[model samples]
Target: MFQVYLIDDEIWALISLEKLIPWKEYGFCICGKSNSAKKAWDDICKNPPDVVITDIRMPGMTGLELLKRLHDSKMKTQVVLVSGFAEFQYAQEAIKHGAFEYLLKQVKREQLKECMIRLFTFLSEQKKKMLETEAYSEKQFWTQMQDQQIKRAAECLFQIEKQEWIGKVCFVASCKKENIVDKKNGKMIQVESFRLFLLGERDENAYGLCIADQEKSSKSEEIKKFLAQVSEQETVWGISRIGDGTQKVSEMIWEAQTALRAAYFSQNQILSYHIKGNGWKKWDELSRAMYYKQNTQVRMQLEALKNEVEVGAVLSDELFSILERIDYEYKKSHGKNLKPQEWIRECDMIHSYPSDKEFFRWLMVFFPVQSEVGSDSAQYIIHLIENQLANAPTLATIGKELGMSQGALTQILKRQTGKNYSELLLEQRMKRAKELLVYTNKTITEIAEETGYTDLFYFSKTFKKNNGISPNEYRKEKRIENEQSTNEK
Candidate 1:
């Protein structure tokens, strides 16, 4: 949101401007307000806001002087002057010198709104052209140059495939489960310790390429694992082991990719790569199956190769294929592509399966015995909450686990499911409590503990408040209902 700083000599004008517009709806935020222009300058210069509003005839420093001062000081804040009829010509002259626009005294909301729209739109265009966002994947790690002339110069300087980084250990890492906000206005793509590069394959937010100092490669992997554990995201590190200093960049990348491939097969977030010379037999077939959009063929190939490697590789591949088909069909029907990443977070759970059979079972869960396609059934955030419920999961704890703050976590939950953290947690707990009440002989205390509450009295109170009955009464009522239905049948 664009930040706006307000300055006016009259107190009423300041108050009216604050209430004149719902600023946020127009993508503007009122950052600071001052009745004195001289006093406001000291505050504004501390951190220049995107836009400044000032009364043309102020007590000491006039709005025209402030506007010229802003330009002289090299601050890029756009200034809008509020003026009376007498100062109309003066305001227009200030605009020629660089004021954004002049607003008449007693500014109407719609009039002010129209001026802001023009100001914001102009500023946005400038910012966009100046800074473009970047996301990195391993495949295109080396070729992210923006200017075609500069890229051609670099191409002449170094061979694309054979460029050498002799002493660096090239690696690719994944943070699939991390609740990362892919950095925006991204002149600097934030991937924990890794820097950003444009990725040609895989979700860029979930993966990054980093080159470690060869001597500290061992320590790097350990530190990376520790960080991933804290975030509860399985991080795969495909290390292109300490080869001779002459290894070409392409060779190291291939080795690192091979290591990552092996890690995926092991159902690991791919923490470390092991050099493997014996490649899989059906790799070509699996790749082809995925390419041809043959979901069954991909699944069959995966099952055949399931016992040969880790379940992670198969499921990840299977998920890509399924998403490919979904995106393809959606495009055919709706005339647009729903990018594969939309369906990917649902399958990030692929790291959990321990056996080949889990592949079929998991597929059944999503695609099931239905003639038509189902809408998105993946509860990505809810699943994370459910997994940690017994541990007395709080929003802060969950946020920490995902490398996000409590507020960021809340926003994500609200955006995805139209619910807040407390509501979602309450629903999960009550649903679990109900299942226990109807299906198990556990006491209320045991159920309370299982549902993440240690205080039985508090749990009982909450259950009654939400369900309109105490635990025992709910359990007895369910049992009576079951018996009556059975007898009536």
Candidate 2:
């Protein structure tokens, strides 16, 4: 119900209006009454009422002056001015100062009720119009934001002059499909393949999912679920940290875009700037391990670095730098030269792997060991072995490639490397299996297939014989070691 305040200099006049007017019947209640216009003015300024009824000729500060004061203060309270015959001119002046209506000192029940009804209807219509205008303004602001009109968009989205804007955060989801529907309510704004949300608005606020305080467990879970629902195999999301009321929306958008690029390049589905620490130092450690040909150290460090990336511990530029440095260092050490097109294709394949271990396995194919015997035939044999490890090539296949008998190839391998052809092949297969076990998130069966072991039990027995542990045990040992090393550091 609307609150009404009654004011008059005479106590009898205030009491008569209070007792005669059935305010509840007109959807209003008299919240206060004053015999002094001065007190009424002070009360109204402190707690502005929806409707104010005041006499024109009060002891000090007449109703005309009070109405003028309210108009100057820009209060939304509607005022009804009352006057005696001596104050008719004062009532006209009250009207000029924005009073809702003026009434005689002797007000009838019907006349007062009519005035109250009109006032309520006007307030309702004005409120409806204001809400509609605000909705339109919000829509326009979003449209302008999509076009990146930063200054104009800010003007529409915030009431800067009134200081009414609150802090906000933005999220951008790049979906695999063009027409992805938002399962978490229809609050997300779709722009092309991107789904964007501003988190300060009422409808968009989910469990207080503000990016500024995303480290909180509840907020983190909300964000995780949101990303999972929107993301597919090729989809990812980026979130911007909290931006203050005055910060430009365009800058927030750019931050989110940068984070999204990081997620895309790192093959992680979600990333944010708010995560603590940097992954560059860990990445550098992995690079050093690779440079020194410490295969075990490299695998361990790579796994640690992948964990850091999944937790949003790296920036996009730093991750890219690490990747490029690895490529450059590998090419320099191996003395392998590739044409421009070939290098591009190889880089594409390296980036296509979803996990660090898979990427490491793909990279190992390029740096196959050259035979230490230094013979042209020996080098060719090593190349064949490296190229066909996935096929588990035999002595007969090597002899056919070299245009020699299997017996001759066997003698050459035994004399030069102190191991037979089958022993050498087993060593290569076991070495690859260990690398896959340490580095990839692939299952045991998948790793076995990749290493040319069709029988899971046979692969497990061979791995145990070679490494003194099963594949799963080896992975666990390496992971524990990585965790210990990380803790020590």
Candidate 3:
């Protein structure tokens, strides 16, 4: 229940307000009470309550004074001002000081009740968003740490050091919803309000992790049942078996991922990590056939790979290597690559997971512009950076979002686009600044904020460095053409 604090100069009024409505019924607990606003301010500052109802006419410290103090101190405790006077100036002052609600001395039960309901809703949404963001950050940290050796993963997990989790282990699962395009569309599936941490996107799959509540007795079946409810048709979940604690999290993740891929053979359901596949032992045989252009043998070896991957006999890496080799060889002989999407379907085969970069490449493999072009990963990175420009997103933060480190992000961007991250970020911001200048009527300062520049002077200087003109000059020159175009239109 949300905590509530009540303050009034008159004892009668304080008791009346306290009993005006059933606070618990409305999701609040009247935790503290005071007859002096000054006294209440100290308690609130020491340990802020979620909601504070205070009399505005208190002698030592008026309700407005308390509200101002809370605001200046950066406390989120919401204050509701109550007074006998019905002055517009008091209401304005209350609003200016960030009072959650203002009520008269003769406040009706229903009016206060309605205000409590709004506070309840507002606070609930705030908590939910905070939890979700924590989930993202925790998963981001997990990914960053797990990429290191096992000891590092263990060290990171123990740093959590949650006493309740110390003796318990969770059956980690990797889940994917096939048709998801973006987080907005993809977040619709909630497995009975279970905690979820989205990892990242690859091809048609939006992948995430669900660490089931460790206290549940039948957590394995519990997770599987909930996941099955949301599976519908396009979702698949893979669960790692309950195992030893913290030290095994990395292994649990690997097992869940391998199990998720193995689930490709089975249709829409949850599968547990019970089987292990052979490593890339047959790649030599398949690669030899592809290099010799043994069309019949290549087809046969590919079929062999399909069987092997289906039954967990071989890793999926070899399977893709064979197909990519086939496509490359076919392009060599016929001057055209095998149509990937069509050939995959015609061959009636299953697929294993590829890295995000490879997946994007495969998406555009058949297009003519595929040659001498950068991967969509770079564009995705730039898009994320632009969206976070106001916060001045840096490489470390953006890299965490993509489950990559700053070094990995730098290497990939440089290798793919022949440009470093700062170059891309500056290019994106300047381009956005140019668009807003020519189109929007926002002030230069506003444009600077929009482009991730907090200092107006710095923004103008950088604009000149990149575009050979200050922001105002660029705006003047571009807006003429823009105005003429608008006039014609």
Candidate 4:
């Protein structure tokens, strides 16, 4: 209910107004009343009300002053000005200051009642729209957050080229709201919500599945009851049989989505997906052997794993375990030099997981060694430098990109990356140059052009200083070594 305050200099008029309106019927309540504008202003400052009905010509901090105060403070309140023809000028100024409705002292009860009703309806509709918009925005935010979290968990569980046990799997659930408008708006149908679960297991490794809890069910029955409730509301769900876990999880999610979509074509309310077998070998077994091989055999097995993930896998304990093991292996291989969390982070990067780099940089500052060598400010400085290096023409160019004075970026880069901007740019240019030398057949001039150096002679000089060898000589040596290895094999 919207609260209302009344202000007037006449005691009889104030009491009359207090008793005139059927406030409760209109979803409003009288919160306070004052004899003068000064008292009303005090009451408002202490306890602001939703609506303020006041006289226009009260002495000492007039109704105009009170209205101005509310406006300056950004208070959300409807103002009603009461005045006679003598104070009509005051009423006009009050309207300019956003008075909701004005009434003369001789105004009738019906006029006051009508004004209050209009105000009530306006506020109610405004509130409903605000609530609906917030609910929609918050839902989208939460869904994106959940999708990102699940994807990260999946990456940690599935290594890029090694299949240790967590095979791919899929889970599907659907939801629908009753009597919602269907396509074309010609008829009413149920709105549906679909959920997919994808996972698997390898050897002794297991990954935990932490789906959002259902509001009206116990933790263990959450997924089951959530699906059941949505189905009862006209939403159908279908889960596919668990498959191999040697492919991208996006494929598995799509497979489960497809299975759920096919429910519309089936007679049964509850359906499960199956691969086309026709007395042939199961795809799961075949994909397991195909994707679970060593890196040397990755190219041969990639297709099978890709197909399994495309069709969705199972949520097995082993799947979670495999991710845990990969995380453990990375930590162990680092010889305790990196934090346990870094293992998960590296896995995320390898799988192209989406992350907030700014947030990640901020988080690293708390690490003991990083705190000593890399302050929070220093990390931002390095990030800015790295970003500018892509097309930096000079130290001034880097500074301009970072919105700093001419030499400002240079000092920060020297402190953070331990080199001036020019040196760092040359270093990165040479690093790319080396990659081209070893991995591609690009010539010295082409590599130089690609590395932002238009002049090949200058590029060669920078490369030699960084690596202590000319670019051509380095490529020649690498070519000979590869040829020798191939011949021996």
| Backbone clashes under 3 angstroms, per model | 8, 0, 0, 30
Index of the highest-lDDT prediction: 3
Task: List the candidates ranked by lDDT, beginning with the highest.
Answer: 3, 2, 1, 4
Q: How would you encode candidate 2's per-residue C-alpha lDDT over 1-489 as one tens digit per residue?
A: 578999988889889999787675566767789998888888898889999998887777988888999999999999998887656576568768899998986877788989998987787677658666875675665446556543433344344224333433333333333323454543333322222343332122221122222223225566566556554544566656644435445445445655656666567676765544444676677667767866557667656666665666765545444566676766676453211111232234345554454554454434333332235555456555655565656778556534578887777777777788767778878888878877789999878866778799999999999889999999999989988998999
> Candidate 4, residue 51: CA error in Å?
0.9
Question: Please, what are the lDDT tens digits per residue for candidate 4 over residues 1-489?
Answer: 688999889898888898897776577878789888887777887888889988877778677788888888888888888876556677678778887887887657999999988988777776657666865664554356447855654454344324333432324233222311232422112212222232322122111231232223223245445455433445555443344444434333433434543443322343345554432224334334333423223223333333332333311111223335433433444333212222232223323222223322332321213123224434554444443333445656434433466665556667666886556666666666788899998778767766777678888888888788999999999889999999999
- Candidates' C-alpha lDDT: 0.61, 0.63, 0.66, 0.54
Put down candidate 1 lDDT per residue, 122-210, tens digits, no spaces. Answer: 87776655433322333245333223322343243245335644444444443432433343422224333333222223343233334
Question: TM-score for each prediction?
Answer: 0.38, 0.35, 0.35, 0.36
Best candidate according to TM-score: 1
Per-residue CA lDDT of model 3 for 1-489, tens digit only, reads 688999999999999999999886567878689999888877877778999999999899898999999989898888899989999999999999899998987889999999998998888777668666965775565565456543442343345444334345455566664533335633233445343444444334444444444557346567766665545545666666665355445456656665666565534355677543454556677557656655446555555655555554443434455566667766775475553322332112343223322332342222212222236667666656654566556888666545567897788889878899889888889888999998889999879976888689999999999889899999899878878988999
Backbone clashes in model 3, listed as residue pairs: none
At residue 460, give the lDDT of candidate 3. Answer: 93
The candidate, 1 or 4, that scores higher on lDDT is 1
Better of 2 and 4 by TM-score: 4
**RMSD, one per candidate, in order:** 18.6, 33.9, 24.2, 26.1
Measured by TM-score, how close is model 4 to the native structure? Answer: 0.36
- Error of model 2, residue 40, in angstroms: 96
